[model samples]
Target: MIAVLIILVSCCCFIFSTWYTMYKNRNLPPGPTPLPLIGNLLNIERGALVNSLMTLWKQFGPVYTLYFGSKPVIVICGYEAFKEALVDQNDAFGARGETPALDPFAKSRRIIFTNGERWKLMRTFTFKTLKDFGFGKKSFEGKIQEETRCVMEELRRSQGQPMNPARCFSYAFVNVLCSVIFGERFEYSDKRFSKLIGIVDDIFHTMCSIWGQEKNDPSSPFTSENLLYVLHSLFMGASDTVSTTLRHALLIFLKYPDAEDKVREEIDRVIGRDRLPRMDDRLNMPYTQAVMHEVQRFSDIAPLNGPHMVTKDVQFRGYFIPKGTNIYPLLCTVHRDPTQFATPYKFNPNHFLDEKGQFKRNDAWMPFSAGKRMCPGEYMARMEFFIALTTILQNFTLSSEKEFTEDEVAPKLAGFLNFPIQYELSFIPR
Candidate 1:
């Protein structure tokens, strides 16, 4: 009789445990069935997270929930849902989710991850500092012109020889940021600056590894396990992503020479062949603006911007999302959403141009994201990319070694940021 009682009690405990889990998750958003304790561990395939999340969006609608070791992750794929959470409820969704790896690095300092009062203070300071350095003014235009001259001199030194433009582009981009932040610039030959740039690249590649996946020998200089992570993030976040986009832009231009010709023609007509294009010319040069927008859209960098954390418990469409819930903003999904774009797959600049050929603003074209935490250096980055791209095209013509096609330039997912496989091209002087 005692043995029978023990077995019955054990069965009751098991039933209760199962019921408790169901009760806890009863009001959570819909998702694939999660196993007890392990949650959805078995459902997640390795190294295909972005693809898997996209598939989940199709199955679970715009908003869905997934569990990672008992932690709830809220995935927002649809633009409307994302807008509702990130924009409408901006204050609630402003906090970045905790990553064990990034925690040590961004313990407090950097603007990207730090939240609350710290984030507000840093963000405000960064914007003011950027403006002081000519981010949206004529002073900034002079700096870009100077940088363009430096690039022209460097390219001229190539003497029409086949040389990779990555290094030069990286230097110009980084220098622009350095001038704005550190109040200085570095020569291309400066070894310390080169090392700093290398460290930045390393951090970017390391962060690209999926969360929880560890690399780097803890002792290595490139290892971004601590304070270095913040530095690495700032540099890599600003430099590599922009540089890779520019590289892809050049490659795409060579592949689509007709588009290239049109852009150059527009530049010539607006700014003329005598002087390099300026930031002011961005408005007057509609074709060039369209091409710039198209490059950003087609590149699709930072598919998933790490993860966001809810600062306070909130209700969304009758679902209660507790504070500290991880939120994944599917940027790629929004950029390619058919509901928002006409031809989500094609590389047409017409997406940004209206019937009259004027640059048209699309709410969906959010490469740098929207709301409070949008990229702080967006204005500076945009001006740099435009000035560098148009100036290069204005001075020279680009072509590949062989009949390289756009389809051939497949994007290799570099962690979160997508980059094209290395390819060669020639910059012929026009």
Candidate 2:
């Protein structure tokens, strides 16, 4: 009898606490009412995180709050809200938010998850080091070209037989990253490398290197532990994000053979069969450029984007967001904003093409995201997208045994990382 009374009192206290907290945050941007313990967990449909958030965007308007447990997360959707928060008020919204799953392990140590002076110092060091090692410049072109050749050779060995290119794409992307950070590239067959890749894949389902050898200053952020975390950030970006994007690009081309043909035609005209596609050739190949941009927009990988935090309390879009409040700057909403794109849902390269058939920039198309938290590796990723896809098209035509529907080729829209459907493709030599 005493135990039952205690349990009843405990339940009452919990309900009161939850309601009081909600009442306190009443001035925050409004959304659906959250339950006591779970907050709005029931509001989200299982296996459709991006869709769920987007649906809320329509119902609650652009800037609104969604509770994850008792905590209020300010979700900024659409291109306008994104620009206003992430760009116009970047500093206030610049702090890294808690990635609950990663926080215990990462401990806000990595470049991607850290905030304040640590992030600034890490970014400066990494950018300079990677630049010195020729990441974003023409000097690095040879490394990418060589890695693409390795991929081409591997595909040729497939002998036009259908195979899942995911593993091959993973190897190529990791090798390019490994080469720069570790000063060595692993063969696709290397057992250790294969194991490492496998571990990375598993973690994405849930959630590199030695450049700091010369730093002697103990006060500097370039400690061995910090360097490892930096490498962790770089590896995670390359292994999953870049490789998944490549998979999406190939799958999209398979779905639209006509689009693939046009890219090939451009490749033949400027890049030709004699050599691997050069970054210089991108200027002359507008169609290819448009297609690459379209693929990114359509894929919408990292849709929710890495969570951010408000550094200080501020008014945005007529709502008050408190300091350290979690923020979800939805990249998915921006890429698919109807106001921004003519046909946002469909995979149309014309979203990036002008009347003159030249590639045009759309600020809404921010796969690397925008503002202070934008990807430091943007230049390298862009180079990979262009050079890798061009090289593949230059060497072979992509085809699939299974005819994928538009939905099949579309972004999975389920998890943190958007993945293309698992399908096999035959790379017929051109």
Candidate 3:
């Protein structure tokens, strides 16, 4: 009886401490009450981060707070909140938050995760280097198209069989940057290139393991450790995101063959089958562009988005956000904002199209995010999208081994990325 009494007393104290923390942060945007130790973990199920926050959005308004294992984060839902925080108050909300999941890959030094002076320097240098290397230019697009020609031979080897195309897609995209970064693109079967591909295959895990081993080493471009980090950043930026997006595009094509037909129709009409699709061809092929945009919107890619930290203690949307607090812009919310898209839930290319059938851009469509930390690979990714998808569709008509079902095309947001489930594709030569 005495032991039971002590247990109850301990529980009461834990509850009191939790309540005190909330009391101190009473001015924070309202959210579900957090429990001690677990915080709001029980409130949010794993793999359903976006849907769970979206449910709370209905009750808590666009901007609200939620605790993940005692770390309170301000969740910005919808376009207005995202614009207000990330755009209007860019500096105050500019710092990149330390993400425990990506700290291994980010190292708090690379362009993706670093904040303030480091972020500014890395971003500036990266942009300059990319521009120098012809990113977003016809030269870069031509380079990507060259790589695409190489992969097309590999895809043809499948001979209408159900095989995974992710490896070839990844190799092509990585090699495109390999030439720009390493000054020489490797053959697909080269031993050194193959090993490099292996490392990038599971890059997030690889970097997580190798993150700090280079810390004591001198800071120079020639350092082997630093070289690895640069390669890792490039792979993270180029390979995985683009490969996953292209793979998703194929899955979408299989699921909605009519969408595929529309893309092919647009491609054949403008570029024709004789020549490979080019970035210059986008203006004449609005339907293909819209379909590609829709594929990305439907994929949701980096759903939660990389976390951003508050640069200074500031009040936003009538809530007091302390400096250094983590902020998740909930970009998936804006991407699926009903007010922004006519059919937010469906995989409709019309969302990115205007009445006249030209590809129209939407403010809420931030697949690569916005503001200070927007993806540096946005232009390259776009080029790859047009080139890679058009090339694949140009040579092959994709179909799934199994019948198309909603569960098949729908994303399994089990972990960090919003990607489709693994399904084989029959890349039938067109």
Candidate 4:
């Protein structure tokens, strides 16, 4: 009898809390019913987070809300609506939101998570520093060129054997980024480098973004904690993304040898085999530029962009969004939007090239996101992708060791980043 009474009381409390939570945010955008604690998490299909979100767009229209626990998360779909929230109406929607899954991981102190004046200060400092550190400049390209040679040398050691290129790519990109962050690069065999990587993984699961520093700046927010998280993000940002894109680019080239041949031809024609590819060479080689853009487009990394929140309570297209509502601009939908690309589902390089064979601009091709809150590392990452890819094609022709069906390379999206499944290839010397 006592046990039954306890169960009944617990049920009543759960009911009341769920009701009170729903009543408070009644004006927020609508979507599926959220459970008492888990919210719409269970509703998301397993291993298909990106696809499931896209499917929900069909039912919910351009914008709607889902829940993470009791917190309301607004999902924005399509190019125009996604751009409006991220690009145009950025003041209200630009702030980063802390979800239960990501909040515990991101310390709410780093540039990727913090908001308002804090974000502004860190962003300004970081961007200025990155620019000063040679981002988008020829000097940065020189570093990438040096790393490209190192990776090519590693590939040459493979001697035409079927090799999984992920490690080689990771080693090269990580060192390049580490040099940018720490003023030097580490050899693959360095024990200290391995330990530093372990630190990055440890920080990822914990939100303790602090390491107390005795000195202070009233106007500055660069705490040791902030610096650590920044370092963590640099390593995290550097570790997988650029490497994955390069991997995907190689995979696509393997799948489409004709396209690979075109890139090699462009490299040979514009820069010659004797010289390394330069960022300036991109202007003269439209097809190579098209290939690079298409790889990003096709890879569709970060399908749901980093979670953003409203900085303040605002009126948005017939909805009243309370301050602190989590927002996800569906980038996968943007990349695959029929309106944005001619053959959105197919791997076509012409999406970035005009009939005159010039590299045409597309505002919708936003892999790094946009607006005041746009990724500070955008230019650096793009430059790395361009220089690394072109140089690789310049030195080697990638061929699949084992034939794969179209569906084989189509790996399911995991977390935020998406790319082809791991496969082996021969880096045949050109």
Which predicted model would earn the best lDDT? 2
**Which one wins on TM-score?**
2
Sort by lDDT, best first.
2, 3, 4, 1
Give lDDT tens digits, candidate 2, residues 343-403.
9988999998999999998889899999999999888888888899999999998877788
- Residue-pair clashes per prediction, in order, are 1, 1, 0, 0
Q: Assess the local accuracy of residue 412 in candidate 2 as a C-alpha lDDT between 0 and 100.
A: 86
lDDT for residue 394 in candidate 3, whole number 0-100: 83
Tens-digit per-residue lDDT, 49-85, candidate 1: 6678888988999998887756678888867887888
Model 2 / residue 300 / CA error / Å: 0.5
Q: In angstroms, give how far residue 128 of model 3 lies from its true place.
A: 1.8
- Any runs in candidate 3 off by more than 4 Å, and if so which? 1-11, 205-228
User: Which residue pairs come into collision in candidate 2?
Assistant: 208-231
Q: In candidate 4, residue 372 scores what lDDT?
A: 72
Tens-place lDDT per residue, model 4, 1-430, is 9999999999989887885776465677778777766788887998778878888888888888887767778899889888888888988888887656666665633678777898787787677667767676777788888888888888999998999988677777778877766788888778887776666545532421222333376546766656666656777767678888888888877778899899888888899989888778888999998888888888887777777888888888789888877788888888888888988877889999898988888888988877776777777788888888888888887876577666765534755667678789988898
Residue pairs in collision within model 1:
208-415
Model 4, CA-based lDDT: 0.79
